[model samples]
Target: MWLTSKIKQLLMVMKPGVVTLNYPAERPPVPKNLRGQPVWDHQKCIGCGGCSDHCPSRCILTRDVCQELRVMLYDGSRCTYCGRCADICPEGAITMSNSFEIACDDKDDITTRLELFMMTCQRCGRCYEMEKSNAIDRINLKGFRYDNLEQRALVRTTSETFSPELLKESDNYKRPSDKE
Candidate 1:
């Protein structure tokens, strides 16, 4: 009877469990809508301060200092794995990836700054963000929407008689020869 009991215990021990995982060697399946790592699409980003605005921990920051357009920065360390940024991104420029590894030793390494040089707006007297301008132009480049410049601006580099629009369009709309 003891031998039979020992055999039964051995059979139970050999029985397989519900699930088994072979990680790294075999790629594990990722669930749908899995929020992993965050990805930034620079071109789509308008720097409108939407993503930075929604961050709960204030890890993301954007400053249009001196009207030089938006200078954006993101702190991955302070971020609490919340999808607020990815959800609030106006241009759909930010997305969460499937990578959870973010180990870092230095605290400063968490802070990431992405600086963009913008063409100043001559009208608003404030620099028209190139990022915004690019987004606008890309939105409508049919050579028809002349009023597209309404949203664009350029910082006055020098006090010239040229309107920012004229300067920009002069190349396309050339001046008539005064020879007549």
Candidate 2:
């Protein structure tokens, strides 16, 4: 019975219906749903750090390379291809690509680098923006001009009005103590 079973196994192994491919020579068939690698678009990115926060392996690194510029580094070697980064990006900056061939001698080969310029408030000298984002630019372009002196004065007043001391000084502002 053992000899018959061994013969049957040999026959199955010798069957011509088996499908095989030479992997090194021919690219292996990748599934359509396969999330292979994450690609970063610096132009679309707003330096939000959403990808870094969502990354499971902690492959994304956001560092202040200089006072004027911020750098975001995506280390592919540490990535798990989880696609969380691509999903969580508010600006749609990150995307998953089909290219899985990331083998390299140098670690930086697969790294994606992005730089964002810091925008400072002209009046207050506060670094309000890490990057000159499109949304803010659009707002400014659509009538809200920060370069206008009147607009700047309005912004300053708006910010100062939020302060307790400033609110106390304002005739229109009534604090809880004043109301009591």
Candidate 3:
């Protein structure tokens, strides 16, 4: 009885023989709608900070360097690839590419940085006002942001105008410790 059962098990295993592929040398076809990685189109992006705000993993970050310059950074190391940034983009600037093999030693290899030149109002140092009709544009940060890209930290603080005090505070931001 034991011999018969062993033979049956061997036959069952042999039925689905050699289903594994020779990976690294041979690649399989990518399936449809695979959310592998996020790609950004700098031309289409309006520096609205919408993607940064909507990112579930908080991998996308935005920093207003000055009144006329806004820097956006996307750190793929922390990204969950949920495709929220692509969907929330009003200008269709963000897209999910179908390249899934992203194993890398350096995090900078997957990091994306965008330096956008913004048009500011002469009277007020703020960015050019957007029309109120579009709700997507309204969901962005109104003032200045100072995210720490080197530390990969999102400083959840903003000011109506560029403030050096706020920038200094962000620089000193430290994560809470569990030891306390």
Question: Each candidate: what lDDT?
Answer: 0.53, 0.58, 0.83
**Candidate numbers, best TM-score first, in rank order:** 3, 2, 1
Task: Flag regions of model 3 displaced more than 4 Å.
Answer: 1-4, 121-141, 177-180
Tens digits of per-residue lDDT, candidate 2, 37-134, equal: 88888888866555664566766755443344556677787789999888767787888988888899997798787778755446534222234355
lDDT of 3 by residue, 1-180 (tens): 999999999999999999889897998889879998899999999887878877878988888877788889999999999998897787889999999999899989999999999876566455334443566545555578899877778888888888888877787777777986
Task: Write model 1 residue lDDT over 1-180, tens digit each, in one string.
Answer: 999999999888788654577776887778767786577777777555556545667667544432344456776766787887786665788888776766789855655565554454446443222343334222111111111112222211222222455335522533347886
- The stretch of ten residues in a row with the least summed lDDT in candidate 1 is 139-148
Where does the lowest 10-residue lDDT sum fall in candidate 2?
143-152
> Clashing residue pairs, candidate 3?
none
Q: Record all residue pairs in model 2 with backbone atoms less than 3 Å apart, i.e. clashing.
A: none
Order of quality (lDDT) = 3, 2, 1
